[model samples]
Target: MDHIRRLLGRVTAAALTLLGVSVLIFAALRAMPGSYTELVLGPLATPEQKASAAASFGLDRPVAEQYGHWLRNTVTGDFGTSLVTRSPVASEFADRLPVTVTLTVLALALTLLIGVPLGVYTATRAGGGRGGAAGRLLSAFGMSLPEFVLGSLVVFLFTRYRLGLSVGTYTPWSEGPLASAGSLFLPACVLAVFCTAATARTTRDAVLGVLVEPHIAAAVARGEPKGFIVRHHVLRNASVPVLTLVATLSAYLLGGAVIVERLFDVPGLGSYLVDGLDRRDYAVVQAGVLLAATVFITANLLVDLLSGLLDPRLATAAKGAA
Candidate 1:
């Protein structure tokens, strides 16, 4: 019951947050000095033509009425027609969302596979092995390197090595899974590196903290295997911080992947958003932002649920509050 209440509360909050963001976006776009009407029409378009176009898009209406109209249409799954594409915003989002989702998932998977082990190794060995120093050095590198610079370096190495590949064009998986994966590989790595470093640092810290606990020492003294003690005792306690790191990294990874995708020339939401923004395509910008926000919010909610599941004490606390 408590879990249910907490979930409901979170959902409500997310909805309100989304609503507020939408309103802010709308206001900011409207508050801009240049006319969106002029953007859609040529610079030489006569005032009459601009007026007619504005009327057609309902821009001629009072701001409140226009907002209400847009809000209602948005709620009803009609995000208005795109000025650039002349298609519904919903349709444009539907077409681009899958590509972004796939890229984000792959990037996140790579981050987890690499980061968790690095963190565990760092924690277990501490100052005892050469690997700890290496981990710290790698983390520093990851933190200092910007995504675009790292992406360019990866591309340079791959091309120079005669890997016979480039990052800008995408091949569909259905057409050739290997080719498609190859295309995404560089970009995914670029997006994952920073996230991996962040998660590693968090995991290392969490594990080290757990290592000094009296209970952990007791487990070690009882002839319990070192693997079992680290896995069950240290990791279990360390997970909360690790999960937070993962969640934050995941959100950033998804958003940052846009730059990578654009650099690589993938047809993901990031690239799409960039195109839309360049053209000042209001509908497309709104739709893309909304999609990004939805993904980020949903990811956070999932993390919350997972955290509760991992820590029964948290669940119990929620239930008690309820």
Candidate 2:
């Protein structure tokens, strides 16, 4: 019952937040200094055509009514058709969403596979175990680089070596898995670098904290081997922060894919978002924002729920606070 209540509360909050975002976006978009007539028609469009177009799109309606129409259309899965493409907004999203989803998932997987272990290794060392300064240096280096610079370096290295890892072109996984994986590798690595650094730092801190606990010291004195201490004591306690970092990084990965996707010429929603902005395609822009917001909200909710499960003390505290 407690968990259900918490989830319901989160859902309600998310819905209200999304509603506010929609209204804000609608108002800001209308307030922008250009008329849709100027964008869709032309400089020479007669005053009569401008008035007709405005009425046709219901732009002449009161702002509240316009918003109501938008809300209704969005709920019905009709994003009011794209002014630029004349295609259904839902179809545009359908076409682009999978590509972005793939990129996000791949980037997240690489981040975990490379980062979590490095973090554990650093933590074990910080716990006064075998490894040395080299791991620390690597973590610092990974942490310092920005994603754009990382993407450029990845492109440079692949191009310089004429490495097959270069993204000459994209092939869908449905076409050929190996070809698809090869094309995605560079972009994924660029995204992973940022996530890895964040995860490693958080993991190191959490593990070090766990190591200093009295119970952990007692275990060490009992001759519990270093490996056993890491596997049983260090990891279990460190997981709280590790999970938090991963979930947060996962959300960043989804949003940040725009840079890497554009760099690699991937046909994802990120690229489409850029195109939408350039063309002033309001429907596409609005849909993209809503989709991104939904993803972010879902990620946060998952993190909260998982945290509650992983640390029962946290759940108890949250309930008490509520």
Candidate 3:
């Protein structure tokens, strides 16, 4: 009963959050200077032409009515047609979302693959050592470098050295998984840089904290195998905090992907959103923002559920609150 109640509460909250985001997205876009009709018709268009266009687009309706209509259509999975392209926004998103998802997944996998191991090594060698110093230095450098700068550097180096790697080209999954991964690998690395550094630092701290706990010392005293202790005791206990950081960073990757996608010329939702904004396509922008928010909210909710599973105390606390 408590779990059911908690789940209901989470669902309710998520729905409300999405509603608020939709309101903000609608209002902000409306508040922006200029109208889609004007952009479409040009300054040479007469007042009668503008009025007809506004009416056709339903922009002549009251703000509340416009919002209500948009909300209703969106509830029915009709995200409306793009103002610029005259194509269904939902179809556009459907086409591009997979690209973004693939990129994000690749970047996250790289982050975990590199970050977790480096963190474990650094934590074990926390006491002054060349290895620890080098790890720390690397993390610091990664955190300091901006994604754009790093991406540009990679592009420049690849071009200058004739590395023969595909930099700004995207390959569809229809070709092959390996080709798709290869095309996205460089951009994924760019997206992963800062996240990897942050994850490593976070993991190092969590592991270090867990390492000093009494249970760890007791396990060591009992002559438990080093690998067994580290795996069952250290990593297990440190996972909660690391998991939370990973969830947060994963959500952040969505936003960061916008810039990275542009740099790589990937046909992702990020690039779609950029094109929408550039052309002031309200439907496209609104759909993109709403989808991004939904994904973020959903990820956080999943993380919370997973965290509860990982730490029984959290579930107990939630039950008590329920």
Candidate 4:
């Protein structure tokens, strides 16, 4: 019952957050200093033509009514039509979302695979002294670089030194899965740098803290295999914090994805969103932001639920509060 209540509460909060975000997006777009009317028609369009276009696009409607109608349509994946292109935002998303999804998932997988093992290895070494020192050096440098700078630097190195690498061309899955994967590899690596550095540092600290516990000391004193102790005890407890970090990072990753996608010239949601903003296309901007909000809310809720499941004390706390 407590778990159910907690889940309900989380969903309610997410819905409310999503609503607030949509309201802000709507208001901000309307507040911008450009005429959506002129954008759709032409600068040379007559006043009569501008008024007609505004009415047709619901710009003449009350702001509240326009928002309500848009929200209603958006719920069904309609999301209205782009003023600039006169095509459905949903269609654009259908065409571009998969690339962003693939890049994000691939980068996250690479981050975990690289970060966790290295973190565990370093944490096992003298309270994170020698190994952690080396990791910290890399993490500090990697984290210090902004996403665009890192992407540019990486692209430069790959093109200048590496062989058979295409810098700006994004291959589609229609070519072949391997070809598609090959195209995404560099962009994924670009994204993974930040995630890997941050995740590794956090995991190292978490595991290092856990290694000093009395039970852990006893396991070590008994001359148990270091691998067994680290694998069974260290990862289990350390995972809660590491998972939290990963969950938080997922939201931040979207911002980086936008930069990485543009840098690689990928036909993804990032580029779509950028084009909308550049053209001041309200439908595209609103739909894109709403989609991002939905992803964040869903991912955050899953992380919370999983955290409770993995650490029963969290569930117990919720029950007590209930």
Candidate 1 lowest-lDDT run of ten:
249-258
TM-scores for the candidates: 0.91, 0.90, 0.94, 0.92
| Cα lDDT computed for each candidate against the true fold | 0.79, 0.78, 0.86, 0.83
Instruction: State in Å the error of residue 34, model 2.
Output: 3.3
lDDT of 2 by residue, 78-137 (tens): 887777787888998887776777777887888778777887788777635457356677
lDDT of 4 at 271: 78
- The candidate maximizing TM-score is 3
For TM-score, candidate 2 versus 4, the one ahead is 4
lDDT of 2 at 36: 74
The segments of candidate 1 whose C-alpha lies over 4 angstroms from its true place after superposition are: 319-322
lDDT of 3 by residue, 149-216 (tens): 99888888976787868777899888998898889988999999998999899889998998999999
> Using alpha carbons, what is the TM-score of model 2?
0.90
Decide which is better by TM-score, 2 or 3: 3
- Residues 186-232 of candidate 1: C-alpha lDDT, one tens digit per residue: 78878888888887888889889989999998998899998899888
Evaluation by TM-score, superior candidate among 3 and 4 = 3
